[model samples]
Target: MNTQSDIKLTDQLERDLIERELGTQRLGFVNDAKRVIAAVQNVFTRLQAEARKAKVVYANG
Candidate 1:
């Protein structure tokens, strides 16, 4: 039979692991964002095509 102390320790250990994994995931996301920001983009020209965005959300009312 597990005691209360054991249960508490297990809970704390799980939380610690989750926090550590989250830190690594966040670092990976930051690295990806930096790469995207460093990408090349064309300068605006006298004759440029209109930019368009896909309708991301549709409202049914």
Candidate 2:
């Protein structure tokens, strides 16, 4: 019952599905990287604030 065109269509569909899944995985990785970058920025910001406070205390004392 299967023709050549039908086989080609099935192959194309399979390729599309694989590409879509890979795209989804890439998006997930990007989101995770963004979250990690944000966390590191927060840590650096807190450290800078603490250093400023320490400097002020040292200068005043």
Candidate 3:
């Protein structure tokens, strides 16, 4: 006994979910952004390690 509005709502949701799963829009950028973020984090970790190895600590006295 669903109304036309209800059917439309359901259809819209299905389409939205399919597009989201396929990453047809901004979701498509998520993987690329994650890769960039990970690369930056890796570089920061390496820099921190090098700084620690060299005992480079800033003391603002």
Ranking under TM-score, best-scoring first?
A: 2, 1, 3
Cα error, candidate 1, residue 4 (Å): 0.9
Return the TM-score for candidate 3, rounded to 2 decimals: 0.50
lDDT: which is higher, 1 or 2?
2
What tens digits encode model 1's per-residue C-alpha lDDT throughout 1-61? Answer: 4798899999999999999999999999999987766552232331232221222222321
Per-residue lDDT of candidate 3, residues 1-61 (tens digit): 5798899999999999998878765666887899999999999999999888677444432
Question: After superposing candidate 3, which stretches have Cα over 4 Å from the reference?
Answer: 1-22, 56-61
Clashes of 3: 0
Clashing pairs in 1: none
All models, RMSD in angstroms: 13.9, 1.5, 7.0
User: Total clashing residue pairs per candidate?
Assistant: 0, 0, 0
My TM-score estimates for the predictions, one after another, are 0.56, 0.91, 0.50
* lDDT (Cα atoms) of all candidates against the true structure: 0.69, 0.98, 0.85
TM-score of 2: 0.91
